[model samples]
Target: MPLGTLDRDPPPFFRQGPSALSKLAVCSALAFFLMVADARFKVMQPLRVVLATVLYPAQWLAMRPVLVFQHASQYFSSLTAAQTAQQEVLRKHSLQSQRANQVEQLSLENERLRKALGLRERLQSPSVAAQVIYDAADPYSRKVIIDKGMADKIALGSPVLDESGVLGQVTRVYPLVSEVTLITDRDHAIPVLNTRTGARGVAFGDVSLHVDAMELRFMAANADVAEGDLLTTSGVDGVYPPGLPVARIEKIERRVDAVFARIYCVPLAMVAGAGHVLVLEPTNAQIPARPAADVPAVVPRRGASR
Candidate 1:
């Protein structure tokens, strides 16, 4: 057949139903209609169920990496938060402990001060309330330093007392502070009277005992001294006032061959731990001055001179 005579369109057996643009418009309209029907009336619900069932395993597999990453992130963040919380708790606990100790110390100090004030009121002699600053630096002697000194009218030989009993005596006085020699000092000696027997003796600080103590020296082996006897200041020593507790007899050693017995005594005052004290004027200050001897006229001698 001649070229001009051939048919311009394809035969019916090989031809499509519509043009591409036409097919695209028709398919888009059908998809829109199906979506609207599914939304409004459940038109494609059965088909959606079948398709979802076929894709369920693949969807689960595809999301595994994302789920793992999210879980790991959450776990690390929680661990960090736990560690931070632990540190905070520790810090707060330590602070609470320190504050508790401070409160306890203050309470103890307050109690001591209150007792000192009460004792001050009961005292018949003039006294000054003073704080014990620290122990004296001398390792060979038992002494303490007080905040009150010459400036506070604290004089040498003044009696120092705590809430319990006589503690020490003012030995050295400075402008702002004073040094008190404890009764337990090795060189210190005091006259004490037994409250039980009314026996008087001299007690010297015992150097043999490891702890602070005194011993009644030069007592007869048969003396009426006993353990647990309370010893008080005799006031005849011209230092501490009479009736002030000095020590308690702890042990008595009587050697058969020895002429005198040794009686060990423990001081009644807080010798090692006193924080507050009262300084009192010496007992001698209160005693009357000794009267001067009257000059007797030598009448016979005068007559001889005339």
Candidate 2:
């Protein structure tokens, strides 16, 4: 096999079918014609399907790079997304743990407060826990509905409380549902007293003008009340028992013409936003408490120098 013979043995480039440009032009013209035929009439539907079937393997081969890139990108994206979700879950768990610790501390402080006030240990009113289903239909009234109703012994005028403080009073009762009026409603009135100065007042909401705030009316202008004072039920009203938390005084103003000082309060408990609540059922008897002992007189100590 001489080199020259080998070179001449097979024509270096044997003529094949059509030239690349000619083949491309013919394919393009056929595709355009087919598209036009399909658009103009539906007669080419079966032909198009058969053509697609014949070209399926080539089409798949042409798209291999794109498919591979898509799959790889998706894998990396999924890994990053999974990491982000895991971090979010960890952060939420940490926040919940912190909240739990704070709740425990608040419970201890509340117990200490009850003991110091010489106030009878407030009997934990027996309550039926309920889940809030929905907000009141009427926008004018600040009310909510709960899952527990007459079936659970929940009745009208029963006080509802959350973990933090008092939420509202049940106004309506149904077979399996109950409606509660938040303390922030205009028509709603609650007897309240200042925890710091012992000043008594009535809390009323003006639904027509104010929604988030309540008014404490009939407070004396010279009353020793201040902002941030905790308002509690005076128990004067037969409806709500005494010493129940009502609201926290946020602002106080005295006007020359007005006879009483104006006090605004924000409800301690979020009645509208709460998910769970306790319906406190009234008890027949008062809470039991030990009588206070009299203070003994102190004698002066005898000292040698004196």
Candidate 3:
């Protein structure tokens, strides 16, 4: 077959269709029109819904692995963060607890110091502040050893006082320590004046009932003693200072047949819990010496003249 006679164009059955640009332009115009119609007239909305519903299961299946991977990563990260946050919270709580304990201890110590300072300021006589060193070795007597002694000028029979009231008296003074016999001791005694009635009475430590207490022995049955009466030192013994608190009347028993009344008193001082005390000079040492003019002259005998 001659080259010119060969079919340059495809036979009618195999003829080319419209150009790609024409097809593209027609499809774009149709797409624009459809979009406008959908926007304005709700055209193709039902079709879109139907297509989405039908393809939903396939889309979900395709996204499952990606969603799972993201969820797993997030879960691990959140777990680590939660553990860290818990540890931080625990650490903060521990620190706060420690600080609270320290604050409480400091508050208690400050209170004790304030009480001690106030007691020192109210005292009239010279005093040396002393701490309780240890309890006395003799268990038979209620006695305590103080840190102050002869080295600190703590004299024998010196009055000891706490913040509340009189505690005891220094009985034995060593070079560095002194032993104080508490007012509740079996051998201790103090002359006390009734604060409410102004009646004088001698308070003696009594241990007859296996309990330490002060008793006003020999008081008349009709005495004006009553419970809750405050007793103060009378300063008649030349040992304790005047106007110091001694004890408070706890009980009073008066029988019709008995001549004396039984009065029990509780000491105001913190005998068992006293941590610090004031040791004052003996009141006897403060007494003025007797004047020479007050001495009486001896009388001469007149028998020789007779």
User: Which candidate should be chosen as best, given lDDT against the real structure?
Assistant: 1
| Model 1: CA > 4 A from native | 1-17, 288-306
- List, residue by residue over 99-118, the lDDT tens digit for candidate 2: 99989977765654443232
Query: How many collisions per candidate?
Result: 0, 1, 0
Pairwise lDDT winner, candidates 1 and 2: 1
Which 10-residue window of candidate 2 scores lowest in summed lDDT?
Answer: 112-121
Tens-digit lDDT track for model 1 on 16-118?
5788899999999999999999999998999999999999999999999999999999999999999999999999999999999989988987888888888
User: Model 2, which residues run further than 4 Å from truth?
Assistant: 1-123, 207-210, 283-306
Order of all candidates by lDDT, from best down to worst?
Answer: 1, 3, 2
Model 3 lDDT tens row, 1-306 = 778888677688765788889999999999999999999999999999999999999999999999999999999999999999999999999999999999997787577667767977877778899989789888888999999988999999999998888899999999999999998898988889999999998888877643657887779999998999999999889988889998998988999999999998988988877878889999888889877786688777988664
TM-score of each: 0.83, 0.53, 0.62
TM-score, candidate number 3: 0.62
Among all windows of 10 consecutive residues in model 3, the one with the lowest summed lDDT is 205-214
Could you tell me the lDDT of residue 246 within candidate 3? 89
